[model samples]
Target: MSQITRIKGSHRAASLVIAGSAVTTSGLVATAEDAVDIRAQTRSVLSQAEALFSRAGLRKSDITRVQIWLADMADFPAMNEIYDAWVDPEHAPVRACVGAALANKHYLIEIQVYGYQPD
Candidate 1:
C-alpha cells in the first residue's frame, strides 16, 4: 500500500507525499486576508517544495524531475533565474516549464517535484 502525507500552509496548498515522491497541488493566491509579492510567492512555492523533501527525509540531490506551470509565459525567464540558483548545478533534476492560467490571477507560478527517498 502507498502511504500518503499532507502539509498545509498559508500560501500553498497541501503537499501530498506518496511513497518516495512528493506532489504539490496548485497553490492559490490569498485574497483580502493576506498580502504577498510575486517574487515572494515564487519563493514560497520553492520553500514548500523543499520542506516536502525534508519531511520525507530526502535531500535536494534526490530530486529526479520537476514540473513548473506559470500563469504567464513571460515569467519563465525570471522563474528560471531563481530555480537555477536554488538547485544544485552538479545534480539538477530534469524539469519542464509550461504556461497556464493558474487558480488565481495573482499567482504567477506553481511547481511540483518528484524525488527519490532511498530505503
Candidate 2:
C-alpha cells in the first residue's frame, strides 16, 4: 500500500496530500492584499499551488488536472491570462472552471490541482 502524506492545514482540511504518485491540493484562494481582483487572486492561488507542488516533489508539468472556481464567470478571461502564463503549455493539464459562491465575499477565484509525484 502507498503511504499517504499530508501537509499544512487545520483538522478540517489539509493543504496538500500525497498518496504514492498522486498529489492533490485543497481548494486554494488568494491571500494577497490585492486578492479582490481576479487577476491578482488567480496569481496568488497559482503561486500557492506551486509552493505545495514543490513540497510534494512535483512541478507544473507534473500536473494532471486543474479545477478552478470563480465567484463570477466574467472573471474567467482575466484569470486565464494569469493561468496561461503560469502553466506549462507543453504539459497542460485537463482543466475545468465554473462559477460558484465563494466562502469569502472578497475572494474572486479559487484553484485546486492534482499532480503526479513520480518515484
Candidate 3:
C-alpha cells in the first residue's frame, strides 16, 4: 500500500509530499536574492527539486510529470535548455510550461514535479 507524507511549509494547494513508491510532489515555491539572472533561478529550482526528490528516496527517472510557471514566456526556451540537460532522456516527464507572474518579481521560474519511485 502507498503512504502519503507531507512536507511542512509548502503550499496547501500544491505542496511537497511523497506517496509511497508511486508518486512524489516537489516543493511549491522558489525564492532568490535580488540581482540574480533567470538561469541562476532555474538552476536553484532544479537543485531544490533534485534535493527534494533525493530526500524522498526518489530519482530523476521516477519523475512522471512537471508543471513550470514562468514570469515571462520568453524564458521557456532557456529554461528548457537547462531542464533538458537535467533529466534523464529515456525517462522524460510529461511537462507544461506557462507564463504567470510569480510570487516575487525577481524569480523567473518555479517548477513542481510529480514522480514515481520503484517498489
Off by over 4 Å in 1: 1-14, 20-37
Worst 10 residues of 1 by lDDT: 26-35
Please give, for residues 1-108, the per-residue lDDT of candidate 1 as tens digits: 566765554344455455535443333332333326556656677776776677767778888888888888887777777777798999899988888988777777
Please tell me which predicted candidate would have the highest lDDT against the true structure: 2
**Among these predicted structures, which one has the highest TM-score?**
2
Q: Give the per-residue lDDT of model 2 (tens digit) for 1-119.
A: 99999997778999999988899999998885867688888889999999999887688888999999999999888888999999888999999999999998999988899998877
In model 2, the Cα lDDT at residue 118 comes to 73
Each model's total of backbone clashes: 0, 0, 0
For residues 1-119, what per-residue lDDT tens digits would candidate 3 score against the true structure?
76778765434453467667655555345564522766777777877777777877777877899899999899888888888888788988998888998877777888888887777
For each candidate in turn, the TM-score is 0.75, 0.95, 0.82
Model 1, residue 67: what's the lDDT? 88
